[model samples]
Target: MTNEPIIPTRKLLLVCGCLLGLTALTVVAYYVDLGVFHTPVALGIAGVKAVLILLYFMQLRYSSGMTRAVIIVGLLWLGLLLAGTMDDALTRGWLNVGAP
Candidate 1:
């Protein structure tokens, strides 16, 4: 598939909508107390934003095979990195992560 926009008009609108939605979501998430699930909710939202960026803005949805493979590889590396970091942070920190 060519890299040309399949629906330039709609894609542009979707990108804008995603951005605005993310902004609104972040604002609302900040105000909404999630108690024990706060971090999970925030992370879930952030992951959604990342997927939107990769699938739409990055145009991976219409990308070449090699490009898609590269993106998948990069995401796998990122997951490994985040997992390692989280393991270290959680194991090391004595700080209060949850709300009172």
Candidate 2:
């Protein structure tokens, strides 16, 4: 195994601070009411949070390119599956209330 330097405590604190700040931002964003863009904005913030966790908490930044590629592909595949499911759900006639 290669001799990799350990991450500094300060850096870890900084990342934690950033994650906390982003969490606060997400909470604030919820009450802002951007209408049609609300979901996209929330999703974008969540994506940033996920990346930070993946890179630092999961130590993916120090990993090989193949590992990163596999993760990206997996996330994309999951996204596609979710999107397809949402599409199908939206197209279905569930309640059968017939246009109130």
Candidate 3:
């Protein structure tokens, strides 16, 4: 037993609780009116859930730094794509003489 660490049962249970709590909150958020930024808020909530999974359930907290960097890169790339698409859609048409 050369100091091989062990995660306690209580901490594991707490993490599980957090996951469930977030899931419930996400459902509630879906039902409520988040006003003008509803979609962005929901997307942010999903990102939070993903981070929780990566940090806890996915055990990334105990993994190497490279793995974490990869996760961050993936998320950033996704954000870039989503932002680019939204930008294109919003700016695709201006005054093109009734270009339907």
Candidate 4:
């Protein structure tokens, strides 16, 4: 049998409350204009929510070392994919091509 750590009901409720608050913040951020900071702010809040879900709901905090390593690797791979896509998009207009 595998041994797993059990979380308390109060902690779970707190996390749930935090997640709800963050969701509300995200919606509020959408209506407010921070110019170039909007996207980063939204993404930052999302990242925090993701971490909370991963650690508590998914039980990654109680998972084995290998499981955590795998999660990290997966995140790294996703980051690389996003970076590549952004690189291509941002550089697309650098060169001008004549209409054929």
Candidate 5:
């Protein structure tokens, strides 16, 4: 008795196409300078790609609620770590400490 979810070929192909298109868009975004908006644009596109891959390739869409919860929690933890790192890096020069 197999418990695996069967995904349709058409849906998989569609997702593949979307991922490829997003990759191309990323390349295009890299060349065009948006100044301050560039980083946000790139990160946004990458986030979309990551979500698509997570849902489709990782089969998260077919996973149980508990499984999804775990994945969400893991992502939240990762975000927290990244936020902490960014905070430290950004605030490094705020207070001047003596160098010995």
Candidate 6:
């Protein structure tokens, strides 16, 4: 196994603080209505939180290029799936297939 350097306690603490702050922001976002932007705003904050956790807690920042590439590809695949699902959902109302 490679000799991996340990993450500093101060850095971990800072990340923890940031995560806590983001969590608070997410909670606040729920209470604030943003009309058509509400979902996007909440998702943006959640994405940031996911990135921070992946880079710090998961130690992906120090991971190899292959690991990063795999993760990126996987996330892209997930995004494509989500987009396809959303498209279907958004278009369902337009199908005009009424109930019997």
* Reference-based TM-score of each model: 0.69, 0.77, 0.71, 0.84, 0.84, 0.80
Candidate 4 regions exceeding 4 Å error are 95-100
Off by over 4 Å in 3: 1-6, 95-100
Residue-by-residue lDDT tens digits, candidate 4, 1-100: 5699788989999999999999999999999998999999999999999999999988888999999999999999999999998887777777754322
Error of 3 at 40 (Å): 3.6
* Candidate No. with top lDDT: 4
Per-residue lDDT, model 4, residue 9, is 89
lDDT per prediction? 0.80, 0.85, 0.79, 0.92, 0.90, 0.89
lDDT of 1: 0.80
- Give the clashing pairs for model 1: none
Query: Which pairs in model 3 have colliding backbones?
Result: none
lDDT of 6 by residue, 1-100 (tens): 7655778989999999999999999899899988999999889999999999999989988888999999999999999999998888777778676522
lDDT of 6: 0.89
Q: What is the per-residue lDDT of model 5 for residues 1-100, given as tens digits with 9 covering 90 to 100?
A: 5586888989889999999999999999999989999999999999999999989988888888999899889999999999998888777777855322
Q: Regarding lDDT, does 1 or 5 come out ahead?
A: 5
Better of 5 and 6 by lDDT: 5
lDDT per residue for candidate 2 within 9-97, as digits (tens), equals 88778888888999999899999989998999989998998898888877787888898999989999999999998877776667664
Q: What TM-score quantifies how close candidate 4 is to the native fold? A: 0.84
Q: For residues 32-94, could you state the per-residue lDDT of candidate 1 as single tens digits? A: 888998888888888888888887877777778998888789889999999998887776646
Candidate 5 regions exceeding 4 Å error are 2-4, 98-100
| lDDT for model 4 | 0.92
Clashing pairs in 5: none
